[model samples]
Structure formats: C-alpha cells, structure tokens
Target: MTMKRYPIAIALAVAGSFAGCWTGGVIQLFSCDDPCYGLDPYECDDPCATCEGECLPPPLLGYDDPILLWTGEAAEEAAVPECPPEAPGLVFDGYGGFEADHVCPECRCTEPSCELPGGLTGSASAACDGTTPTSFDAPAGWSGACTAPAAVGSGELGSLLIQAPTVSGCAPANDAGAAPPELPAPWTVRARGCSGEAGVHTCREPGKMCVAAPVPRPTGFAMCVRYLRPGAPECPAEYPELREIYREFDDTRSCTPCGCGPLEGSACTALVSAYEDEGCSALLGAETVTLAGPKCVAGPELRIESMEARWIKDEPGTCAATGGVAVGEATPKGATFFCCQSDEVIAVP
Candidate 1:
C-alpha cells in the first residue's frame, strides 16, 4: 500500500494536538521519543502512541478588559466610564430593580350659607288655615323696624303665615395643586466595557488557558453575559452558561382616590310680632320660627294693624373630607442576560 503525505501545517496541528508546555507566547512541541511523549509524528520516524505523564490543557478565552456597570434612581442622572482602546465604551443597557414613593393631596369643603325669612301673610281664618287670606307681607329684605302693611278689623286677624329662610351655596373647597405630576422615568444603568478575543488559537487541544479576568464584578451585577439581541438569548459558544433578565423598566406608580363629604350643621331662625297699631307701638303677640318656611300660627284675639320680623339665630355648617393616599408600582422591561466562560487559572512559564 502507498502511504500519503500530509502538509506541514497539518503536521504541526497534529503535533500540537497532544500535551505540551506553554512557553513565552507559543507552544513548544516535544519529540515523540521523549519520556513526556508530545505526540509529534514527524519528530521521529516511528511515533509513540501513548504518553507517560498527564497532558497540559488548552488555553481559555477571556475578555481583554472588564465589563463596566453603573446604576442609580430613576430620577437621578449618572455618568459612564471610558472603555479600553478598540473596545466599545459603557452603553445604556436597560433598567433593573426599582423603588418609588407616590401620594395624593387632601380634600375639603366650603362653609354653608343661608338667607333670612321673607314674605309674611295674614288670614282671617283661625290657625292660618288659608281662608279669607289678606296680603300682610313685609317688604323684601325687611328688618325688624315697624311698618304697616295692612289694617284689620277687631278680631279679624285669626292667624299669620311666615316662610322660612333660604339655605344654599355649599360646595367642596379647592386644593393647593393637589393633583400629582406625570409618571417618572424607568431605572437605568450603563454596562459592557469590552469583549473577549475571537478566532482559532494555538492552545493545546482539550486544554484550558489562563488570561486576565476582570478584577471585581460591577456592583449589583447579576453576572457577566454576552449580548446578542435586545432580549435574553442563547449565549455564544465561548460562554455557554447564562441567566436572562432586564436592564430597564416601565413605571406605573400612582396616587390613591380622594374627595369631600356632605354639608351639615347649618340652621336659621327669626322672631315675628303683631302690633295693635300701624306704628307697631302696642305689641299684641310674638313668636320665633325656623327657615322651614310657610310656618303658620294663631294670631292674638285683638285687632292687628302692623307686623314686624327680626332674624334671631343663624348657624353655619361645614363638610368633612376623605381619602388621600399613595399607591401602585413599576414593571421591568428591555431584557438582557448574564453569561460566563472557563474559571481555570494556568501559571505561565
């Protein structure tokens, strides 16, 4: 059988396949006849099939520089670090964990208002039962001063009609810019300093090499990962193991509900009197009534020529307030990952 010859490049690759020591920056092949048996088939006419001692592992892949990271509050701004030559600098990756404080303003109500009694009438029917009625109403906005509205014969005024005051204008008070501002931005961080070397190396087959590893990992870093897509994805062949996660986020924080209560505690009253003369000189009878209006009462048996009404008591009311609190949370967005390579450290000779 005719033997086939392989090229020098192929021979060198095959010769470097077996175990050998790392010197300076290159792999030094040993002759097959040597006790260590480096498996160089071309070194000796007859190649040794086996080695007497354990073989050295190949070199490992490591990043030329360390991966950088920076993080802070969503509202705070942070500065990024410069990268090594020929490598990408710190970039805005995404957001990670988050924190927030949300709140609402207090609520309140304005004071209640009221108007005194107006428009009084008289009836010849006893008990003011709306029979043979006559207009004895005081002028609009009339005070307690004496005035003759109408004259009545002896024993003609049997009853009187008085309408209660008007109550109104109770509303919720305004807050000092109680509404909240717009939502804040998501948490952020800068990372990924540089990458490891690429392409085939001269390291021994099945042997790991030692190179410089980034000193201490960045603070709060889940782990070192190679990024391929915007989201978590399969790691490169160099870094096979990995964990998926996000670097940025979407904020949903907000405030609770708030409002005011019903108005209450308001009241009003007035005193009314009938006089025997138009000048209101001789007092015939008098009574006090509330603003529930159209109140009727029996008149004095004597004749009434005039009448008078004076506001006696008026009480203002207030409303209670409710609900003003903080609530809600934020969600994570923009995915990424953590990946790694070999951890072996080989001593250089």
Candidate 2:
C-alpha cells in the first residue's frame, strides 16, 4: 500500500505551479522577457516600443500648433499693430474709409473732387447777414437786382460765397460810323423812335416779326419787322397777293395763312419753288400765292401740266379728248385743283 506512484504529466504540472508562485504568480512559459526593464513596462509586447529612456510624457499636448499655455503664472501678451487716429474735416464713407470735404446738395462725385450742377444764375434782392456778403458778381450773361447784399454759400468744405449782379441798366452803344453788332439769331433790331438828338436802335422780341426790313439809318438803325400776330392786320400793302390769299383762307382770323409770305423782298421764282416744296401742284394765278385755296377749278380748256397730275377716274373710264372747251367734263365735284402754270391764273376770255 505504500508503493502508490503519480503520472509523469501530473508531476510536471506540480513543479510548474511552484515556479509560478516564486515569480509572483507569473507563468514563465509565456511571460515577456524584455531586456529594457521598466521603460514602457506595459508596452513590452509592442513591436514599435523602445527602451529609449522614459516615454517623453506624451509630447506635452498641442505640440504641432503651439499655443500659450495659461498657467497660474502671469506673463506678458504679444504686441499688436495700432490704427491711425481720425483726421479733421473728413467723414467716413461707411466702409472703413473717409471722404474729403462735406457732400453738397445735388452734388456729383467726380475723380478727386465733387461738382455742382449748372443752373440759372441771377441776382436777387436779399438782406446780407453777418456770414453772407452784401454783394457778389452774378453769373455770366445773367443779371439781377437785390435790395441788400446777399451771399450764397456752398455746402462743401472751403466753399466760397457767390454774389448777384445787376441787370436793369441800358446796354452800351456802338462806336460812331461802325456797324452795329448783329443780334442773336431770331432777334432782329428795331428803331425805338428817336432818343433826343441820337437815333436809338433796340432788338425786337423773338418770333414777333413775319418780315425783316432793311435798316433805315446807318448808325442808329435797329431791325424792325412784322410778326405774324392776330388782331389788327399788319399785312404790308406792297404784297397785295398775300393779302388776297389771307382774305380767302384766314376767315377765322388765325395768323397761319400769313406765314406763307410773298415774304418781303423775295423773288417770284423762289416763291414758286417754295410752294412746290409745300405739296402744291399749281401756283394759281398770283405773283405770290399759298396752297391754302380751293382744290378744284373748272375751265373751258383745262390743261394738267404738273407731273403730280392724274386723270380723274370717277368710274374707271378713259379721260375725255385732251383739248377743248368741255362743260362739266374734267371737274371733280369735291376735289381740289391747282393752276398748272408758274404765273398768275388769268380770267377766261
């Protein structure tokens, strides 16, 4: 009974257990055998782990993009750039910038400066205050009268005051024996009778005259002409043809017909050309005439001479034989006719 024996495998397990207990319960069979002791002790099995000193305390956080570590200790901050102070007489353009001078009313911004619009300039009577001047020069070609001196100041910076000029005085006269200065277009000269010993000439109002007459005197002559105005007839007796046309066409007293002048001093040839241009096919029988007359005319022997003439095809039939005294033949009841010749229309014999 004392000769009992264990298996060889059981005997080896008992010996291994004793060795494990001696090494703090670590089994030597699969235990890590690191030559670098205590260096990353937990990383003993990691292939990339090295025994190079202590693990460097994990790179101290944010090593790539370093920032100031605000510890309990105090330190000075980094310096920053300063901006320039604002200047006087300048206003911000609302976008991180400033503009020179104050903006003016109705002002337009031009490069390097601002501009005011052009307008009528004249002097007006106004009392001058302390800041405003009593008098100033009016704009060119303009005149005005002010009881007191007045100044118009600009809204912009360093703007100057403007003064008005007087416009009521008589214009100066020209030199003796010299031709008078020509008036502006549509403004002719007229004689305002005689002023004392000297003859006086003045410009007539624009659009007032229908005909321009020659200057009567050499020095003090002003242009005076007839204008096409209604009421009292100013038709010159020299142009009897125009008067006759006016009588026939101007029943309503409208001045329109008078404009078709045997215009003073114009030739008959020019008048005929003017009438043709005005869509008149014939000149009728007048030295000077207008298109404002009856359209149709009946005659014993009618001849259509104008290139604008066409046969009256009432019902689409050939015109009657070219020449002869035909009664009621070529006459179209409500149609207009014009005398074909350049001369005046003569009464049938």
Candidate 3:
C-alpha cells in the first residue's frame, strides 16, 4: 500500500519547517553608537539649549551688522564658496547607522563584532532608548497615516531648489546706475525650511553643509537679522531656531585608518534669493535657541559646528525633543527637546 507521494503540500510543509530553523535577520534597529563606528550617531541638538530635562531659551548671535562679519578687505565683502553648486550634486539618504545589535540598553552593550567564513568582518546593531529608532527596513506591518513618525520639518522633500535669502543692508549697492542693490555672496536657509515638525530636506551630495539662520553676522551668534541697517527700523533674525546637518559619503568615511569608517559630513543649502517680506529659517541639533526679538542677537554667524553630543548615561530620555529644551539636564514641561549643549567652533566674521 504504499508509494503515497503527495507533492506540493509536502514541499510546502518541509519549506515552512526549515524556514523556522533558519535564523537570520533581514533588518536591524540599533542605537548607542561608538565613535569607532562613526561620530556620535545623532544630529547636533543645538537651538533647543536644554539642560536637566528643562527648556531654556536659545542663545543669541553676537554680531550687529554685516560690516563686522569679516576682517581686512575680505571681511568687508566676505565671500562664501561661490554660492555652492545649484544642483545639490547627488542625493544620499543621510541616515546614520547602528554600531551593533547585541544591544543592551542596561549595559549599553551593542551587537558583537562579526567575521564571515573567509574574512569579511561584520557587526550587529539595534535601536537604543533615547534615539528616534530608525529601522533598517521601515518598520514591518505598519498601519495608518499616523503609524510612522513624520519627518521633523515641512517644505518639499527630495532635491529642493531653494533661492538664496536676500539681505539688503548686508550687500553693497551695485556700481553707479548698474543695478538697484545686489544680494550677498550666498543665500542662507529659511526658518520656514528648518522650522517645523517634520525633520528636514538635505542635499544628496555629501560634503560639509552648515547654514546660519538669518545668516549669523559673526561667530558666537547672538542675532539673526531681518535687515541690519544704519538707522532703519530693525527686524530680528528670521528664526533664531536653526539647524545645519553635514554628512560625508561611504568611501569618504573610510579614511582615518580606524576599524570604523571615515567620519563623513554633509551639508544642504536652501539659499534664499528673494527680498521684501521673504526670509528663511532652519533648525539644527541645538535644541533650544533664543527667539527672534528685540533682545535676541547671535554671537557669531560662523561656527566650527560639531554634531557630536555627550549626555549623561542616566539622562538618555532628557535629550529627546519631548520635554522642552534640555541643556545638560534631565526634565521639562511645555515644549520640545530641553537642555542640549555643544561647544562652538569659531566666528566666521
């Protein structure tokens, strides 16, 4: 009685059985980065200026006018890098990565180092508590419009062709009778671009991209001006709340002879080229910054701008954007991320 050969169903049963035995992950969700993996895996949380989980007002830019933005003759008409290439060169999904997977939020132990059969070494990674928790593959089986957290800011996504913001007093008039008044070397990003709930839109071409909201007149910025003039009524910097995210490419991160890749940087420009009632703004990791007002002035428009941040081991939750601005602290109430801090590089002017 028996050569009972049932085919498709038998094959399906065997395949399903083995599928369970085969253990491998198609995606990874990791956080808690090591400098060895790359620079701290989070955008610099400036602007928010939080501490102890409480929100503090953002710092003001320190300069008064464009005239002070440079030194010698150069500073007088301080030039920027030829307004950068129009096409944001190439577009790269500048998402930072997880260092390893065997992650333990308790011990902060990440995935273990990996070596393939021959020699291709690999590592495992996973998500951490405080970070935004991006998955290698967008979370599986997500439902509803609200299922996924939205990007921080608004403004169209992908290859943004933004015009340089125009600063009237910042520029000198054209040679007698030529043009009315020319704009400055390069335009800065807009608060509109960098100021919302959705994250941001960045250039695919990776380099070092950073913009001073309302164009910082100098370093240690204390103000973002609408139009710095001799005697005209003043307008505070468009949006003192700003963000400049710089990232590098794959091969670029291979530098520095370390096991980890090169710490690449990226910059996206949303140059505003309009005048009269048109201004721009962007937000960086400086979670808290001074508001645009009578007393608000930036220290310097130029800064070394580093994105790496160091939060106390115990205060992971404090760094999040939920509790207002936390600068070197651990709590907050009616606002965004509170108590974030970073060191300033230098003043451009």
Candidate 4:
C-alpha cells in the first residue's frame, strides 16, 4: 500500500499529539534541484548563496606612487633632447619654452682731451685781482711765443691776470656711432621635462626613465627633476624636494651708462715782463705766475712802453673715467619642485 506524506509542520504536529517530546534527526519539506542542496551553506558553490556579512569595494587601477619630474635645456645652436621613446607610458608632462633677448655689450671709453689757457690781461688796479682789467692779450693764434704789444698807458701795467685751461672733449667710445649691440636671439634656448605614468612598472628605474633624443633636435639639452604638479607650494607636503628649472628668463642685462668725470692734473705758468721801449729790449719789472693767479707785482714808476710773455711750464690734464661697468643679470623665470623616493638628484642643464 502507498503512504501519503504531509508537510513538516503538519507531520510534526500530529506526531507530537500521540507521542512524548520527539527528538528528530532530520526533516524535509520538499526536494531541491540544486546539487548543493542540504549541504553546509559555507561549502555551497551555488551562485545564489546568501552571504552572511558586509561586502568590500575593489582597489584602484595603476600604481598609487607619486610621480617625479625631470627637466632639460638647450642653446640656439646645440641639439636638445626630445622626450624619450624607450620609456613606454611616458608623457610630455611639462614644458619650459625658453627665450633670452637681453644682452650686455662691451664697455669702452674715448681719449681725454683739454684746451690750453688763452686769456691773458693786465689790470690798472694794484691788487691784480682782474678789477678794471685791460687787454694785454697775445695774438689770437699765439702759441706761447714772446711778442711785444703797444706800450701800456700810465699805471695800466700794475697787475696781470691769467685764466685757467678747460676740458674740451671726452666721452665713451662705444656711443660714438653704434646703436646697442643686437639683442641675444629671442627664444634662443628651449627646455622640456618628462615623468612616468603613476604606478607604471617600466618607469621605476633611473636612466631607464629617459633615453637618447631624436633628430631635428635643438641646440642643447639636460636631464633634470621637478615636481609632477605645477603651482605646488614652496615645499609641497607630498613632494618636499627642491629644484630650479626655467621656462623663461628675467633679463635686464646691459652695460652701465657712459660718462666722464672732472678734469685733473693740468697746470700752466707764464712769465710777464714790462719794458720801457716798444721793442721790449729794456725791462722795467718781470713776474713769473701760474694760471691760478691774478698776481700783482711792484712795477717801476717809469712809463711802460711794451710787455712780453712766455710760458714757463705747461702740462695737460686728464679726466677720470666713470661708469661702463656691466650691470644687471638674467635669471630663471619660475620654479618647479621635485620629489624623489630616495636622495637621488638630477643635474641641471
């Protein structure tokens, strides 16, 4: 005969009324199609198994390490390296396009020149201080030779006045004809930097991170290091490394303005003689004096007929040269910091 089976709850309730408390080994309400059915939930390989606790999120892709930067520079004539190709996942992370239009020209000076003392006069005043002076002057083209002029009127030969010499021409020779030297080539040099991809395995090695540059290249280049991020603070928390790289320059380079100083070391002295005759053959009195004098000397009371003068000592002076020093300077435009995992430092170009 066939026996009918009921649900576990109904069968358990009927069995409980007829018998005392039942201790059961196992019970099944229905059969499951799953191969894992009735097994420990932890041992189940089922895709629909209910998990017991909280789930976790996945980690980010790529290396999580900070990126370090490098810089380089080149002259107008030399070749500067381009970003290396051997380092895969490398990027043209930063650029330092360069320019230098400032220049300092050679300093120069012209020879110093001076004029001779020319004005000579006689004064009727006994003090010889050029008061009430009269022309005892030599001829316009006189070259310090002795000459006799018309006899002085009574009392007109009491004193003589001589004028000092002056400076005539002096200056910087460079300013004579040329405009300033042509400014240095604009944007003459250039610079660029590179860094590896974050967490990139290939970028982890030194020198391997960069390689020989390609052709059609610039004049000069260098390998350098910099902070990966631009505009970072003076010392960034992540990158405390310090370095200097230039994108441009601040150039005020120039020669000092040309100039000349006061005259020095010039001197002249002359001898003046008074004569009783027009030919200046007989002298009444004579005095030796310098350009610093309006010197007066006691003259014989006799009527003065003529006068003559001759230079005793003559020496030209010089002017001190001033200015002409090279001034101003050229400096890197901005700063970019660099950080390293160790104490390794990259040389600047």
Ranking of all predicted structures according to lDDT, beginning with the best and ending with the worst: 1, 4, 3, 2
lDDT of 2 by residue, 1-349 (tens): 0111233244343322222112333332221232223444333232222221111111112111100111111111121111111111111110101112121112111111111111111222121122432222223332122111122332211221121111121111222233322221111111121111110111122211111111221232211112234333432322121110111111111111101111122111101111112233443221211222211212222221111111111121111111111112111112111111111222110
- Clash counts per candidate, in order, are 16, 20, 135, 11
Tens-digit lDDT string for candidate 1 (104-187): 455555666666556566777777776567777667666667778767678766777766776655554655345644554534
- Give the range where candidate 2 is weakest over 10 consecutive residues by summed lDDT: 65-74
Off by over 4 Å in 4: 1-116, 129-131, 138-142, 146-157, 164-247, 260-267, 272-286, 298-311, 317-319, 334-349
- TM-score for predicted model 4 compared with the true structure: 0.40
Candidate 4's displacement at residue 164, Å, is: 4.9
Candidate 1 vs 2: which has more TM-score: 1
**What is the lDDT of every predicted structure here?**
0.51, 0.19, 0.19, 0.45
lDDT of 2 at 55: 14
**Candidate 2 at residue 324, lDDT?**
16
Q: Candidate 4's error at 71, in angstroms?
A: 15
- Candidate 2 local distance difference test against the native: 0.19
User: Candidates 1 and 2: which is better by lDDT?
Assistant: 1
TM-score of each: 0.40, 0.11, 0.12, 0.40
Residues 174-285 of candidate 4: C-alpha lDDT, one tens digit per residue? 6634544555544433445443322121122222222222222222322223444557435433334444445555666665665567757766566666667777788767
Quote the positional error of residue 324 for candidate 3 in Å. 67
Best by lDDT: 1
- Cα lDDT for residue 251, model 2? 12
Error of 3 at 124 (Å): 99
